[model samples]
Target: MMRIVVTGANGFIGRKLVRALLDQPSLSGADGAPVPLSDLRLFDVVPPEVPAGAADGPVTVRCMAGDLSDPAALGAVMNGGVDVVFHLAAVVSAQAEEDFGLGMRVNFDATRALLDACRQSAPDGAARLVFTSSVAVFGGDLPEVVRDDTAPVPQSSYGVQKAMGELLVQDYARRGFVDGRTVRLPTIVVRPGPPNKAASTFASSIIREPLNGEDAVCPVPAETGLFVSSPRRIVANLIQAATLPAARFGRDRTVMLPGLSVTVAEMIKALRAEAGDGAVARIRFQDDPRVRAIVASWPARFETARATALGFQADASFAEVIRAFVEDEMGAPHKDPVS
Candidate 1:
């Protein structure tokens, strides 16, 4: 029986991950039989709308809302004997860049505090912690294709915080305080919500807004490219990261998950292919240099050999990405967005 804790459990990826975990028969234990989850604690700053029948399964679902920086809040979820921790909480890119202090408190301080809680609660050092890192951790004169060995040189505050968090995770794992694995994710495309402060929000906005019958703005040039993954793949990879044996991670635990390298023009082309030319027309290009510059600093190509070898997977194409969004979010008989 696994006692699981997911911080940021209300966010886009977090909510989806919680749903997946609840539906699964097991967490893929080594004994051939599945490891049934006994308890699932979903912690977020705001109370997440609990999914229908979330608590009706064999698992006990606990919804918690509190500040990540608050000790009492961390204590509520980390009472003791937490088998796995999916640390998904963080201040996102542009939001962190806009408010440095808030980013530090949530991304850095809160993360460190969570690690401490895990250390104290699981004195036996048996907890498996999977931290959702970002590609932003790599910046400033990156190679054409970043690899597992590529060093992190973050430019933005959000990137810096993630880089720092990665280091802390490595050190904690080294000291045997926690078994930590950091999966550095690319920009998640077709996120199922309205635009937020993330410079990359336009990536999702271009497809999601138009599909939802709204006009959308593109802040970067048509040729601007980014490394991206779908929400479905990310959620699956997050669970895979947690379920794998601790020894499989070896000495270094950071993994750059596989993603599609897509330019804005290419993405629009895929959107057009999926939803028609009218959907393409709904996007108006109005470049924001600040957003452009921030996004431009991130590397768009990677040879994720290590992640692939570890049995992780990537989306087949951008078309699949868009289709997945439509089917999952739109409740589709699959209507064309232009219609």
Candidate 2:
């Protein structure tokens, strides 16, 4: 059985990925089918919440909680044989900018350390590494639709750190130290949790607030557009990145993910349509200069032909995204927003 190690196992995407990995069946080929729960090593700052019935079987689960920034901590975790490593731990954009030092240490330095550890462990070169990057890598002067070939001009400290990590991933892959793939993910909307420090937190808040019977403030104008994906879709893409045929990617080290580009107005409209006018009434516009400036610098749309050609998929529309969040995350009757 191939042992998989997932960093950030307690995080939103990380937790979901761990559950998915645990549920995978053993003896299944990478592309053949899902692997079972018995073959995973989950690492995070906090222990993940395992399913209630998971303890009934002969599954092997190693849960380690520690600071990933420490070389010794990572060494201990990477000591055992690892077949794949999913790097998802990082400081979000807003928080990263707030503390540049922490951002560099966790996002860039820790990532580099992890890759180094992976290289040292696999003396024969035997593990696939998937690095989760962000669209924040592109900013400043951007085209209306960013293409796969677009050069990244990161505007925030977080973006710079992620972009740097992508470079390290490419360098490591080129040296044959690890089979690395970096995916530049879009802002995941309707995230299932309390508001995080990401400037994009508003994207999820508009949906979550209405669900919890509270009002949400839209910091950007109605016409402000941005790229977004649902958490489920993001997890699917990450899994695909790990299992897809290397031949499809060719020499490209990083791939842009396909995402829906919508404006705040469009998002509110979708939420209102699904929940009701009363829900819409719960949302009001309140602009914050810092958030507005940061969000405005981000690319509103992307042309991800490369990712599409490789069989990656995205949500069809923001409405469908809202519906998926309502059904999957909220678990409530789909209510139409009160107009």
Candidate 3:
């Protein structure tokens, strides 16, 4: 039997990840062997809504809500020992940029605190910790196509924080405090909620808002390219990052996940193809330099040979990304989203 912990459990990715884990029979242990999941603890700033059947189900589920910076809160989640820790909590891009202190508190300091907790008491061995990072970590004189080993020169506070977190994860794994793996993610598209403070929120809004039969704004030029993945691929890759044998990582613990390299124009084209010109007609372009400058700093293409070799995957095209949102969220063909 194993105990699992997922921080940021209230967020969309975190919630979906929890659901996916519930569907699983077991998870890979430190020994690289599958073990039955005995308990799952969801930790977040707010109480995460417990999915149906999880409470009385075979696997025990516990929901915890509190400030991650609070030792008492961290202690509650850290107690009883943990076999795997999926650390997904972070102050997103624009929000972080807007408040440096909050970003440092959540993304960096809290992350270090959690690692210390795992080091102090893990499941008789190091815990398998999967850290979700962002491509925003790459900036300034980036190669036309970023490689697995591209040096990160972040241009934003959020990027700097994530880059720092990645370093800590690598160091922790190196010190034998934890078996940590960092998966640097591309901008996720068609996120299922209303816009947050992320500068890249417009990426999802352009498609999601229109598909939901609403007007949307595009704050960046159509020519702006982005390296992106779907929520489905990210979840699968997160699980993959956790289960893969620790021996496979060797010295380097960071991986740039595979993603589609596409332009905003191409994305709109795909949206139009899927939902028709009506959807395209709904988007109004009015550039906001703040949002544009922040997003433009991120590298838009990568050669994820390492991630691919490690069994990770990416969406085939932007069209597939749209289809996934429609299938998973809308639950039916849009036929006429504009009605």
Report backbone clashes per prediction: 0, 18, 0
Best by lDDT: 3
Q: What is the lDDT of residue 212 in candidate 2?
A: 76
Candidate 2 residue lDDT tens string, 23-126: 55342334656555345677887776555456665566777878888977897688667778899999887789899999999999999998888888886555
> 1 or 2: which has the higher TM-score?
1
User: lDDT tens digits, residues 1-339, model 3?
Assistant: 889999999888998889889988588876777898999999999898788888877898999999887899999998888988999998887789889999999999999998888888863447888999988888889889999888999888988999999999999898788888999988899899788877789999999999999999999999999889998889889999999998788899999999999999999999999999999999999999998987787789899999998999998889989988987788866443311
Mind sharing the TM-score for model 2? 0.91
lDDT (10s digit) by residue, model 1, range 1-339: 889999999888998999888877468654435688988898998887767787577888888999989998888998746988999998888789889999999999998998888888877767888998888888888899999999888888988998888888899988999888899998899898889876788999999998987899999999998899999889889988987777777888888999999999999999999899889999999989999987788799999998998878888899988988988798976443421
What order do you get sorting by lDDT, best first?
A: 3, 1, 2
Q: Which candidate gets the maximum TM-score versus the true structure?
A: 3
Candidate 3 segments whose C-alpha is farther than 4 A from its true place? 333-339
Evaluated against the true structure, the overall lDDT of model 3 is 0.89
Q: What are the clashing pairs of model 3? A: none
Question: Clashing pairs in model 1?
Answer: none
Candidate 2: deviation at residue 254, Å? 0.4
